[model samples]
Target chain A: MSVVRRSRWSYLSLQQAPLLLAFVMLGITVAAYVLFFDLRLHHLPTAFAWDSTISNALPLVFVAAGQGIVVLTRSLDLSVGGIMDLTNSLAATHMHSSVPSMLLWSLIVLAVGGATGLVNGLLVTVGRLQPIVVTIATMSILQGLAAWVLPQPGGNIPASYTNILANSNSPLGLVFIGVVAVFWLLLRRFRLGIALYAVGNDAEAANALGINVRRIRTSAFVLSGIMSAAAGLFLAAGSSGGDATGGDSYLLASFAAVVLGGVSFFGGRGSVIGVVCGAGVVTLLVSVLFYANVNSFYESFYQGIFLIGAVLLGMVVTSLAQRRARGSLRRSRRRW
Target chain B: MRNSLRGPRSSVLAIRLAVSALVGVLMTAGTIATASASSLAAGKDAHFTIALSNSYIGNTWRIEMENEFKSACKMAPIKTAVNCSIYNANNNVPAQRSQMSDLIASGVNAIVTDAASPTGLNSVVQEACARGILVVSFDNTVTAPCALKVNEDQYQMGYLWAKWLAQKLHGHGNVLMVTGVSGTYVNEQRDAGAQAVWKKYPGIHVVDQLNGQWDSEVAQRVVSAALPSLPKIQGIWCQGGTNGVLKAFQQAGRPLPFTAGEAENGFRQLMASGKVQGYSIGQAPYLSVVALGLAYEILSKHLSAAHFKTYNLPLAPVAVQNSNNVKGKTWFPSLGGDFFADVAQTGTGSTVAGLCLASAKSGTACPSGKLVFSFH
Candidate 1:
């Protein structure tokens, strides 16, 4: 058997299309800022802008990345929002000014998130339940639990927590984002990562190859839960409080980020890198619209239009590449 | 070719579903509309830019609240002195925070807000305060210590309503407590106040408590469901969706009990028609106008933020005895059941009074074409 080799450029243009889309989205965000504020490129990256934008978008970034993982495994976790709400409630209610309590409660929150994910994973794999049904049920249960933990939208998250996690005066939170990216990069090299892609590509094939499909799928969910918990902690920090229902908004937005990131819902494709940028795009678009002074009533209209446009653009690029590849293959066949 | 065709087709379907879902999410992310009227006379120089950053606009009360602010901006002094903008965040905390950041960046003189969360906006509100921008939050006020708040005491609203219900029952009755959305600051405060009043009247028993969610449809459903299980609810103390609760009683063919609830149009209509005897006190929609006026007062007058304290506006309780006040000014007969009746101040004061229904419905100026807001 002979193997065919492709150039780096070809692989990047075709396989890494999501990154390209992310770049386009980032471009639009920058253009929106410049056009609306009438500022030069040099004036774009202020510490204050970075601080506010990154801090606010940080929670979404983690959530979308977790969602990206779930999507990669061809599953949906509707309970991400509920998990976020529960963990946020837990962190806000228990985390004190002391470092030990903060650390201790943080672990507890993460553990709770993992436990919830385990439940989802077990139900999906062992119980043979649909992912959507399982997650929807878990979502409701988690939201109720969140309300039980913090009956009202009141919790004393210390100023030190806010400063350390998501300070408004500094863009230090970007370091945490970098850490998430690095974690994703490292995971890509592991056996579990390969198994995730293989199982998502084809469950039967993966099982035949002895890849432990159930375990891989379960691990993906566990990772997603941990990430969502991290997101909740960041949300609590950003808001400087705890709210039982606060995580409700992040649910749909995570799916939006996954789609915009060009992560195929069919599974076995895309990167969390693009998902992070997609989260940024989702967030930056709001600021861009605000600065552009678009009529408020039509804000959602524009957002929908933009999402469709981006998806269409991705499809067009992919189809063009596919046609080019087919043409080359036909020419080679004739020559042979 | 079949494989490729089917792949793209199914993927397209998935993408469409995702797109529509995203759109649905965006639709509720809120609108950022600039309501800066350009037809101002060119004589006065004291200009201030005040923005109303509201949390949700899905309900009638929120719409009326925003309309009042716009109407105020178009009237005499505010029209000339203030350039107003309105934004709705659809009850999303992050969305509101980003809007707050933008409002700060734009360097608006003041921001009048009905916050999504009491503490969710504390960080951004603090940033705004540090920037010397006056932040006045009304209705669902913020927990930011630096921001000025203008709101009717939610506790007082519940306390007064419960007190009225207790009196109507002669201090002995099975009253059903219909509370607002659970896990909310306002709902908790209001529920607590009502419970306090009930505790004093040992005979006044709260047999069942239902979560109305402050929506008419939900209130109707919950009240209807509970009516069967309940043993003769003698009095109804509804936090909101007053009309819906009454409609449930009517549908069930039960006698209309003495009620105390929000200033919904239908509730007032029932009282005016002698179909029900109750007290109506609303967490006024004009609270936005009040907050706007406060922001202007601090900005146009160059008053320091320290000069003002949390203005807990008095609740204007309209009793069932006052049928004359129900139809025209307090409650509009032409309006829908959900329309909040407490859109304008009924009495003469240095505050916003004499506002017409058009001001609440469509942001049109009153006949007076003048707005006055003075703290005395």
Candidate 2:
């Protein structure tokens, strides 16, 4: 009876790892905010501070959410940054003052994003190309196209549109986040989502179980592309302009967010909610450092160290839990 | 498998080699055009070939500077007397150094550069000067004594602005300072200048400071974020992105304070409309043309090298005519919000520096004459 109980406890811990990591990240974000507030009473953020923080994290959050799905299927989308640049350029160049024009251009941006993803999916699935090579090649092509479309960063984005997207009181930003969350929940209920996990765990076994591994992988890339485009729109809205090279920094940050959120780089782990929290943690770290009056030159260095620490801590916890479980299993076997 | 890959790899290598060879040949041909165009200084009928090597073309200011230089190249006596080539590197110091080296190799009579580094390109500048090539470094200049320098006193630009803000606030108020990109020499010097002036006035309290990155968007975002955490501000001292700083105040529903900012169109517009009380100053885009004119004068032996080894161009305080109308001669009512409005062709005569806003924008050749340099 004791052996069975011990095994159950270990199984529960294994299942709870990602969720536990997310809670820890959320705790860190709160502590950072409190420290930032304590630096000066006047520095205390307003009631809507959370809203603004969410808005700031929206771009990375969206990308990480999609990346979480892709990682679960054991694939990576390196082309997300390129897609973002292309989308940002399109929005800045075409989205004008009129409401109808803005709506029209936004749809066109989404379609372009989806089309780029479709191409990436087809290359990976149908062409049997390595995902990294195919995505990198596509990223280069998209970057060149972005540069061709808008050579410089100047474009006229209407103030009204920017205000709506950037305003803390506005529900528009929340709506975008909510849509992503709801989509992830609905995806969890679908057969494709289950197939993603199964294929990631063991592709041959999943194939033998009648799962279309190729289709699942292709769908993951498509979703990631769409998410990156949406993030690009958010960035365009925030900056009220276009920069072809601005999205370059997000490429690495997204990977860091994914790993920090407890998504295994190897495959078959993590959740969308955890990824969002991971993005929040990364953004909050920067804000905390900024408010703490750290030199801007050293900010990037501290961010790098924090990311490494989070990843290493996650690895340590996982290995320790696994070792304990293995020891318990041996003792149980000996007693039997 | 290795043999199969080798077939495509070798073909790719061959294609790359062919492409590089074609590029090399075209570059040589282009350089030859400039080299052969240089006329003897003895003959008024001959034209001098000059090349402008700019390190970064990522900002509006650089674009405007390039346009001004191009227009000046096409303008009058210079147009008939000078041929100009422009090369831009994307903010890489090594790349710019190599580009300058290539310009030196092209055998141009003069090379004008807006350097990427103050010291990184000193060796290249020295080499160019040693080759009898007139090298003039403008904007972010080099430290090489051989290269002629053309720039505004950046420290004074900051000092004057801070002095103005201190007086406007009666030397007693909480001020928020918005700075440019950190670790940049310009940003550091400007901060030091401001601090020097502020230290003189014990009442003038700087409540907070933040990096605005010399970018309007970044300035707006950071200022907006910092607003909720600060006390009431009576003054703002911004190195750049003044317009964005003002926009942040507006968004936060605060009254406009006494502001000293760089010359941006939106900031000038606000000042002209009486929405904000401030002074605007800028390192003019026309400085490039000024530098080029200096280079030409030196090359033609019209000016003494000793007189212009180190030149400080006058920093003009952008004048605002308090008219609600944007039709003031100094500010444009029709141009985009990002256009630098203080652009004027300054020299001895109308014929020599006859640069207009249209010519600067369109790169059309305007009439040129001899440019008199005010050496200090």
Candidate 3:
């Protein structure tokens, strides 16, 4: 009887590699964090509670999640932060007097975000430009437009809206959960999701298999844009209005979070769950550093160092696991 | 790829998806029930919103300005309290002008500004005033005539520096003057005041003048740079705060060079640290809050000139120092130990007696052995 088996190359090329690696990296990061900060089990609560420093990180989590999706599709959304900046102002300006009125304003702002993302999609796929340059241009344009919209970091997001989004955990968290679940289901079963994966894995092969590469990539960007906008609106819930400078710092953090999540810079292999875990670790690390009274300047440098160490640990762990499995296989085959 | 494009081509399916998404957004917004009406006094005839535009919260002085301004807002009449909000331009003048327009659109009744550049902001000043929005500028004066100008007399800042330095050195020394941004309002007056007073004291020579640009770090570098160039630099007359100067000198291993500075907490801290010669002129930006109070009074015509004068609100003066003469003058917190004692009265006797050349009037400045509370 002929035994059908996967090749070693196939195992190395599998998308699961990035996911497994991300999980291991996250574990190592959490462990190292516990050691560096001297954070004992007694310090942690049964459930994560939102506080001032943690709240500052919500937008970072949101944007990083969106960027994670984009990264999984072998692309990056450079305009996420800029799109955030634009939408924040749009929400602030249009959302006039009263909670209901402000929410309607946010919806309008979200639509604007969708539209902006669509523009980026058309530029990259239809125009056939590099994602980096395309987004760099849109980033500036969106930020400029934001400054034009709000001018100064003034205006109110209305207590009714911010009170719920920033302070209260009403249905927003549930909706966030819903978004993740829906995304997971789509990735697992939906045609569009499969096409997206196929394109990211190998665009030419996907094309030969009859996938419209451009369409998949464009749709990926659109999803990314929407997520970024949602994150912006969420952040506006915290500031309760618009700040033109508010979203800028998040751009770098999102990119860093994606990379730290064990997502390859080359892309095509990552999961939302991995990215979310990465965000949790980064957020926890930052807040712990703050509570530890670390100097403000060293924060970014420490995070970078942590990333380097996490990546190295991931590589070592994966290699060791591979060697162990190989030894086990040889032993079993020899016995046979 | 062509085959994939044909898979989802039903127009009806696309329409259903689009409609469903719209519904999703609508339902989500409805659930959130977010409020907007961005005004504190919505649909109220008596109350009004006022926008306060600052160039930047660039220093500790600006921070204190904010602290005091917020405190003063609480002191306002509850019913007609000014709905004041601040727009920090982050040191961008053009950005500030654009902010001014946003404020106008937001329906703020009055604006109190610290002009980023006195000349360039005229157009916005003109536009704001034309819209019947009262404009008052403080800290930095507007070249275009605004209704009220409330700022520390810049000349007084320099004159006091020179006087204090000359006295500290027994009326004879090579003095170093560290001024702020060269072409602006404050620097010009401060330089002129220093030069004018130092001309009378032939022995008090003006050896070197450097623009410290009102930044503590810059002040430090300039003072350090100029120290070696001076011939036995008997005194240092800093037109602005000298916390930076003291820090730089200390860090550079340079001993005390008889310094005078803007009366500020920085100077007080420097004095307390025993690093500075201990004299500064504090410009309370909270004066503008008072100016805002005055502007509202003027606009509502609630008080006449006499009644306004009777309000007894003026620039609250406090000399930054460690002398017994400057103790208990202002709200001296723990760190300000003996710093503000008689600080308000620093320029009182000198202003009347002409003893302190920094005072604008002869018999009204601080007496001998007392420092004058002058603005920079």
Give the alpha carbon lDDT tens digit for every residue of B1-376 in model 2: 4644554466456546644653554355334434443222223464677878787777888888888887776665566678776766556443454456545544678988897655445545665777788888888876667888888788888888888889888889998999986535577778888999999999999999989998888999999999999999999999888889999999999999988888788888888778988777777787888888888888878888778887776554343324322454456767765667667633233212466675557655544433334343
Q: On residues A1-336, what C-alpha lDDT tens digit does candidate 1 reach at each position? A: 011233334445676776677776666666666565543133454567668888888999998999999899999899999999999988889889999988898889889988899999999998899999999999999999999999988787888988988887887878988998999999989998888878888989999998888898889889899999999998888878888988989998898788888887888877888888888888877777676565444556666776776677667656655644554454455556
Model 3 DockQ reads 0.02
- Minimum summed lDDT over a 10-residue window in model 1 chain B is located at B34-43
Can you tell me the DockQ of model 2? 0.01
Clashing residue pairs, backbone N/CA/C < 3 A, model 2: B47-B81, B76-B368, B352-B369
DockQ of each: 0.40, 0.01, 0.02
Docking class of 3: incorrect
Return the interface RMSD of model 3: 19.3
Best by DockQ: 1
Worst 10 residues of 2 chain B by lDDT: B34-43
For each of the candidates, the C-alpha root-mean-square deviation to the true structure, in angstroms, is 4.7, 23.8, 17.4
Query: Cα lDDT for residue B296, model 2?
Result: 82
Model 1 lDDT per residue over B1-376, tens place: 5665665576576557656754554344323323422222222654787888888888888888888887888887788787777887867787888888878877788889999888778888989889888899888888778889888888888888899888888999899989998888899999989989989999988899999999888999999998988898899999999999999999999999988998899888888788988788888888888888778777766455576678877565333344555568777788889988877777645366656788899988899988777675
lDDT per residue as tens, model 3, A151-266? 65545666567655554223355455456547766675888777766777888999999898888888888878887888887767665656665576678778877767766666
